[model samples]
Target: MRNMKVFFFFLLFFSLCVEFSRGQKEITEVNVGVVTDVGTSYSDVAMLCINMSLADFYSSRPQFQTRLVVNIGDSRNDVLGAAAAALELIKIKKVKAILGPWTSMQAHFLIEIGQKSQVPIVSYSATSPFLTSLRSPYFFRATYEDSSQVNAIKAIIKLFGWREVVPVYIDNTFGEGIMPRLTDALQEINVRIPYRSVIALNATDHVISMELLKMMTNPTRVFIVHMYSTLASRFFIKAKEIGLMKPGYV
Candidate 1:
């Protein structure tokens, strides 16, 4: 009976040690949050790329002690939805880093949440120059700011000798923030902006058609369109229906 008791005690000790070692090994897991509109084509592609890159990275560095665990949250393409997603990632998932909330409007709130949580928010698609003024250390942009593209747009206008242009953009932070720089760039080259047309991100097809028709009534044939690809696709579809893709349009 004495020998059997000792044997059971030793078995228990061995089991505890094994469990402790397994727990220690699992402590190397790092949780990362991906917040984006999964409904969009851009984010669908981005998620695939991220998964492939992570797989390739882990395969290439098999000896690495740390492992990354990805947790995805769909922002649903809205400000409140983005904030809720970020909050869930930070509070519930305890993610160390956040990658995206694709638009500037979404990024604005996520940056604040990241700052409060001391988590880094990395954005690859939010390109508003307005975001730069916030100067939050927790916010990191992997993509070019909208201001950076203004010069390229200006060059195009100059090349075509388009004296006047109309700016057609979505009514959101991403669209609003880019205009000041774009307007300044166009003014530098003596190009005039006759009017500005704003379309809501969630605008219906009928609304988009109306806006296109309003734009068509004007004499300015050249238009500078800046918005998310999803909305931009709708805008172009309506523009095509209105014959804006013809030779007269610059």
Candidate 2:
């Protein structure tokens, strides 16, 4: 009886040690990989917080040991440059995942490389709906695509009880890709586009503004500006100057 009692005590102690070791192992191992676009600063709110949030997900979740390898590229929104940057990170650094190439143009090239290399690339603000179905198994996005935003715009129009909607979309992929969907959704809501304009990203002068103002004439009261940050700011400022938008709207 004495020998049996000692054996049972030893077994219990061994089990406790094994459990403790397993728990310790669980607490220490985690990694994640990130890639930020050159258009954004490392300390910039959009780039830093967005990438950190993904890394934080694995760190907080018990399922992963999230060790991260982040690489910032100097593409300045160039597609080929972004692709090359991604290739170097994946091939040399062996990053398991990437989260960037912040523009549709950049993502366009990177997606092909990512598909070929078997690495996953997740984008935050790429906004082009066309990219949604392109090599989709590897590409993921946290935000709604341009199409979804267009749907949202349609819903907003309905909520505001606006009859005529004039869409002022940029001529880029981000804008063109979504305009059709927005138009369809608005049509379903019995809304019509009395006016529309597709302007390039860089046309800052009143050439486009005069055209937009003519479209904004008494018929269409509400205007939806579908432009990137820089262009949006420029358009808003010019629109305000031309009395198209009120100070509050600005």
Candidate 3:
């Protein structure tokens, strides 16, 4: 009887262990790649948001068998750097999806890579119309194309009764891609573009100031400025310094 009791106890323990092991699910890991220039505030905020979202998703769904893992790579705000980061993520990390290269210029090459590798490339802030996702099914744009805003700008011009306007934009893929749409939109409303000022992405304060001075000499008070936030901030600072922000200026 003692032997039988001991054997029953051992069998029960073994059964419970096997049942517990069966109940615990194996974690399925899905690796996601984040490629961005961490030096910029935009990328920094993106990283924070991505982390928060991942944390919230996992915390709210404890029963989820699949876990998403994020691997971040800095593109260093250049084409070559972006390619390198993407290559590392695709080859070394074997990420399922890649998020960002920030600008359309950077996305141009990365999109091609993603297509070849059959990985999705997601961009939240790249707004250049030239980088069309239609060309590459793997490319996804989270933000609206820059051309979409041209109609709103045209409406504003019509409401204000501005006869002519000047567009001051960064001289890059982002800025150039919107020009044709903007011109067409403005022309439809009989708005004339007296001049289009192109500011280089790496232009210095002095260069921006000079450009503003040239614009001030012109009679057009209503100016449309389009660029990344970092360059836009500098432009406004110089505008304020030169009294271009005074009354009667738009």
Candidate 4:
């Protein structure tokens, strides 16, 4: 996915470069924007990879007379922040294209700005199916939508013969994005969903433990975990700490 992101971004800037190169004598610099949650570990890694990819892309293709200059923006992991970042980049930095807004909710707002500004919005990680409904030619998703995985999930549930299943997901747009498709898939397999567990993005260990404890009272044992990796890891740890990972529980 990261490689695809780099490829898409390069494709945008490269196209611009091609146009800029024609009727130019000296090397031209093209400005592009990368907006994401700046302080997080994954964001740091993504930024590093983007920098490395840009360097490698140019090093081997030294004949090209166009260079892409990156402008980074911190979205602060908020929807409005992402929109603001894109607007600032478009107005102030005059970036030709935008790389990210991270979450689907953030992308939701950023897409509108892109529509008004006529700048392309490309995302590598925002996988909401809702984005496609907008029918905006400016928006591009590097990754597949959450609904794309529902068929596999349905097949697995059918194979396991799990009569009852519960979806454990985040409360935000990322979590809700896949629910409709997954729900339909589970219904097709005759899997009854008694409850939907919603975890907050900033949920604490104690909160996760309480949620697990609440689930223990229910009859359902099968849980479809759909959430961010970091929060899911913490949730599983808390689950194991409370004996939720033992036999008879899925």
Q: How much is 103 displaced in model 2, in angstroms? A: 1.6
lDDT of 2 by residue, 105-128 (tens): 788787888888887777766778
* Tens-place lDDT digits, model 1, residues 1-250: 3223222322333344345445354536667799988778888877777776667656775655566678999899788999999999889999878888788888999999989899888887788999999999999877778899888899988998999999989898988999988989998999999889999989999999999999889899999898878899988998898999888996
Task: Tell me the spans in candidate 2 whose CA falls farther than 4 Å from its real position.
Answer: 1-33, 39-43, 50-66, 216-218, 246-250
Which residue pairs of candidate 1 clash? none
Instruction: Evaluate all candidate structures by whole-model CA lDDT and list the values in order.
Output: 0.82, 0.65, 0.82, 0.87
Per-residue alpha-carbon lDDT of candidate 4 for residues 1-250, written as tens digits (9 for 90 to 100): 7555667667667876778588776888888899999999878988888888888888888777888889998898788788888889999999989998788999988888889889988888889888888888889888889999999999988998889999999998889989999988888878889889999999999999999999988889999999989899999999999988999999
TM-score for each model: 0.85, 0.73, 0.86, 0.93
Model 1 ranges off by over 4 Å: 1-27
Q: If ranked by lDDT, best first, what sequence of candidates would result? A: 4, 3, 1, 2
User: Would you give me the overall lDDT of model 3?
Assistant: 0.82
Q: Supply candidate 1's per-residue lDDT for 158.
A: 96
Q: Please give the distance, in angstroms, between residue 153's alpha carbon in candidate 2 and its true position after superposition.
A: 2.7
Per-residue error for 182 in candidate 2, Å, reads 1.0
Could you say which candidate leads in lDDT?
A: 4
List the candidate numbers ranked by TM-score, top first: 4, 3, 1, 2
List, residue by residue over 1-120, the lDDT tens digit for candidate 3. Answer: 322322232233334434545555886666778899977887777777777665665677566656667798889988899989999999999997888878888899899999999988
Candidate 2: pairs in clash = 30-65, 30-66, 30-67, 31-65, 31-66, 31-67, 32-66, 32-67, 32-68
